[model samples]
Target chain A: MRDKVVTAAEALAEVRDGALVAFNFWGPGTPLHLMRALQERGVKDLTICTNNYTLRADVLREQGAVDAAILLPQTRKIIVAFSGVQQEDSSASVEIARRVQEGTLEIENVSHGLFIERLHAGAMHLGGIYSPIGIGTSLENGKEKRVINGVEYLFQEPIVPDLGLINAAKADTLGNLVCHGTARAANPVIAMASRYTVAEVFEVVEPGGLDPDTIVIPASFVDRIVRIPDDDPYSRERRVEQTLRSVKYRLEKMAEAEAEAAQGGGA
Target chain B: MKEKLTEELVAMRAAKELVPGDYCNLGIGIPLNCAAYAAEGVLLESENGVLGYGPVHDRESLDENIERVDWDIADAGMRYLEYVPGMSFFDMLTSFAMIRSGRLISILGGLQVSEKGDAAIHSTSKDDIASKIGGSMDLSWGAKRLIVTMTHCSKDGSPKIVRELTMPVTTRGRVNLIVTDMAVIEVTSSGLVLKEFAPGWTPEEIQEQTEATLTIAPDVREMEF
Candidate 1:
């Protein structure tokens, strides 16, 4: 299958004003090439949805491309709980937290667990997903709550985005993409949940090149492919970059800790 | 390695322990220094991506504009930091899970290790009034083997080696070895066995700093580099 091969910057041409753009990066498999392109284009007032607010702060902040966002409540810097890690504060999540607190940015909170189920439902083209992920608590606001199997579940609507930015280890002309072990976290889910998906790969190969069993994302859903340079070892430099990215994040935590202390140590 | 903090880092170079394929997380403080002393082959996984980052460039070389991570640069021998394009907070959290899920082979840091190996890192919970658990919950709970590198006690002559935890905990019963400036204490079911002590310090001097009990080896030798 013949396909168009463009730089990540070019694929971002589809992004329009007020568009709800979603990124598929989960930290390790970020589509930085495409993010760079969007930064270069200088798009404005984007409505972004993702698992976290990190990429928007690190990349999109340069272009003022994001005005509002939909993300897991825990993805914000001062979160109480999130997927896998349980309850913890994230420096990357703090950047968005600062913006939200300053009123410079607007955010919509989704619980981490419900966020995944909603995206999964969207990928499956389901109308809605019902789960006990967020029920009977403050997160139940404005949502239809019902009892099923003697358990309470919240009716979470499907999440669909106008554009999806993704990263992959390799891709074929047919759009089949493969990711490294840990890099595959959310890219496939984000790919299926978006209308226009652009993939940035470490290597671009032929259509029949990738193994069928190893294909993490099928080309049928992808709209574009871009290449990003993989020059550095996954070592201290990455840690440094992570460090720089989290300075603001750590400061936010210190501030939160101070605030929490002032409030008599109650969450 | 020299006795000085920066010089002891030199020992990390000679020890040549961190392997190339290993996915390691450096705790804050001295362990962060380990990144600079890390052996050539290791891949240090930060909570964020952009691996192989050198230590911060000279202030003159810095952009002088944007805020950067505290220890955001590596040394000259350090490789170029690769940015794992598009990775997000959730992604790092998952990477941390990989650590918490027993995926990481080894973790290095310093601590007040309870006899059960429960690490109290957030704070003593009595001093400064406020203490919160960060990623320490995952790090101490995860990691195949936990290495605590620090002095054996607090500044006010308080022992880090305790029978029970009195402060907020990062993890419970996760410590494997305690690498201190004075000695290497291994936590056993009975209690802490002082495996080695600093060249100039004695078991009694070491105990003076600790509030808990200490057992000295009959043939104590200098700490291995």
Candidate 2:
């Protein structure tokens, strides 16, 4: 059994250079404190993996913590799927894209289906799995294709990170963790696939404090717990923007409708 | 039909029959207009995470503080949309899940439709491949009934309704209905059946705009609206 308590920076200090790190939560629910701690510890040459590139843009860059990042191509910048603007331009995508173009930030672009399949395969402890998701596309490069029963299957390699960072809303002293809504995307899989895992929780209580059924992430996968007393404003902001940007095109469509209606009425 | 396309859309809305609670999607270009006149109780689900949405609200009244997915200005039609957060590109998987789960009732989009019900929205050339297919593939295979909306004739007077799609298909055998400015064609196991045509357009004219041979319905009426 591992000890349950540690300072966020101390927990992050354990990450070695060139290790692959995966973080839970996209925006604020991410273990920002731990990320910040890692930055302050002067960690370098690390390969960071997450659904998105930046946690809180300000915090990540200010600390200059990340040496490199691995992400899907489509996941590179947050753009309104229709209009193509940086989701919140002032915050992250622009800078990250700039870095990517400058060759400072590396990317590993995977198709939407293939990425989840990779994680699911990693969680299952399976060897590279077979699927036709990337068969003839650009993603097929560096991949092997095999025919079974006259059907072709593309072989995608598994993704396993060295350290997993997650944000838990609640956890017991034994290191079992739980996440609020929308935090489950890559956290559970990352925790299971990583070599070591650390979590930042809003509250750390005695053993048995959290019900067994309520736990989204089990304690057996956790190695350290860091308590974050307050909610993250950036994460909240990301959630709100995500909701808005997703609908921005629909809104524009509405505006077009009103214009037509006005013209029809005038005629 | 001043702006031939816009007038055609209004006609399509009036002619097409919509069932209440049908999970429908309006694709990016042409189908986007369909949402404006969606009948009551018809929930509009966007790939970015909105369901049971209303029409777009006034931009002047927009909240500077509340932004969605990419932190852009969200419209009223977008309110009550759920947010799926994730690592770098993970939210996309969730969005595709919503599409591929066969939960989407109907999907509306623009395209060149083949007789096989294969719809192509990506591009006519291999050079344009990186233009982003978005959720088209997911929606094509996932939605129960896929509808393709486009002009019957291409700009050079070529046909979009083809015997075989010349472009790479987003999905195979996914299209159920094809609504054009001139008529409505449903792809059946046998071939293309002309379900409805606009008032005054002849079967020959419809066939002229189509590369495929069209079979006219005996009781075809001027597309209702």
Candidate 3:
């Protein structure tokens, strides 16, 4: 098997301007190293397709670290399942909100299932999928529609991404990937759908060391593997600790503000 | 009948629809409260890719070391309920496959539901740039049964159970049952049926709050906890 190990910069170098990139934004599967490298590369007009575009604010608030470095000014469009704030007092990513207002960023909100199915269509080399999910919603505004069995269904075309940046728990020399726990999210499907797939793993082992049954993605689907360094701040344990500390800090700050308010009210 | 039911009572009433061994998806908001009231053997599924979840863990009650074993924390770092045996996690494709294949019953919250069983839950009129659809459209279209739980009226005193949805429709003709603070209604081929009302609420009172004309069931009774 051909060796797939490469530096994160080398792997990210393959991406160019105006490329459609499919990414896994869920939990441990977020490819933080590649994302930072992409940010450093400063590619423009990239369309990011993912489940949620609020990863930047979520991570910053929860972990006090930045994993969604891709949510920068260079991103011209986003096809996501969820976007914007839901509650009156709650807030979304300020940058994203500002971009949308300035007409610099375009967003298409699809349901989570349709988002995955569109990727599945690309992976399967099929034309598109027919589903009734968005038949009557704004999601169906410009999409092709067909009536089958007297029920209307929307025709969602395949989203063939130019690059797939995914994360995995372990990878063999040949780039066969295995994900631990819930980190296996969108990585498997996005890896198959993109023209070039780069994987960032916590550990890289010799070929055949990974159990055959444990491999979630095969070498054929992966073009490169970038092993994250041991001391990386994005490491699972470190991120968790940082997140807990940030939570405690925020709570303490809130308590202090409350105490100050009480003192003023008493005076 | 009682004047108005509590949110927990509304969820508890909705839980009565779940049968043992049923695979279910509970949306955020009031539908999430159904987890605590669900009957035994009803497996709960989360759209972020978890199945067979138990009741959500109380932050104060969680024993980090012991409870962490069976629980799977979501990507957002929110701890889900303890996991039941046979629980599994997969990628988004597999999770959504179960939803699109109609293998799970979906319980969701809605902004408005029309008499024709159409539901509008995703975006409000004020949201212009990003609609924030989430998984509501998928869950509405794909689930075997789509049960909606929400307050009967919006905070502005407008009815949510209406003759025609004023909000953007998430999915048309998908809602099966609606459990609200005021009443429990079923969407039938004939139209919206008022099956039961809160303890202090009469069928006439619920009708006054509802925008749609309701056909009170012949066997209608006061909601039981």
Q: For candidate 2 chain B, which ten residues in a row score worst on lDDT?
A: B68-77
Clashing pairs in 3: B1-B199, B1-B200, B2-B199, B2-B200
Give the per-residue Cα lDDT of candidate 3 at B91: 84
TM-score of chain A of each: 0.70, 0.70, 0.86
- Model 1, B1-225: lDDT tens digits are 224223364235323446666656666555666666666656555533333343444333233433442232222112223334432222333454465566554445545777777776645543221112334555565677667766566656577777777765556677877766666677777777777666666777777766668777777666555
Candidate 1 DockQ vs. native: 0.04
Residue-level lDDT tens digits of model 2 in B109-173: 55578887877764565433122444565566678677787777777778888877777566667
* Interface DockQ of each model: 0.04, 0.15, 0.50
Which is the leading candidate under lDDT?
3
lDDT for each candidate structure: 0.57, 0.60, 0.80
Comparing 2 and 3 on DockQ, the stronger one: 3
Q: Model 2, stretches more than 4 Å misplaced?
A: A5-8, A21-108, A134-152, A165-169, A200-209, A226-267, B1-115, B120-136, B149-169, B180-183, B189-192, B198-225
Clash counts per candidate, in order, are: 32, 21, 4
| Per-residue lDDT of A46 in model 2 | 65
Candidate 3 at B223: error in angstroms? 0.9
TM-score of chain B of each: 0.72, 0.80, 0.91
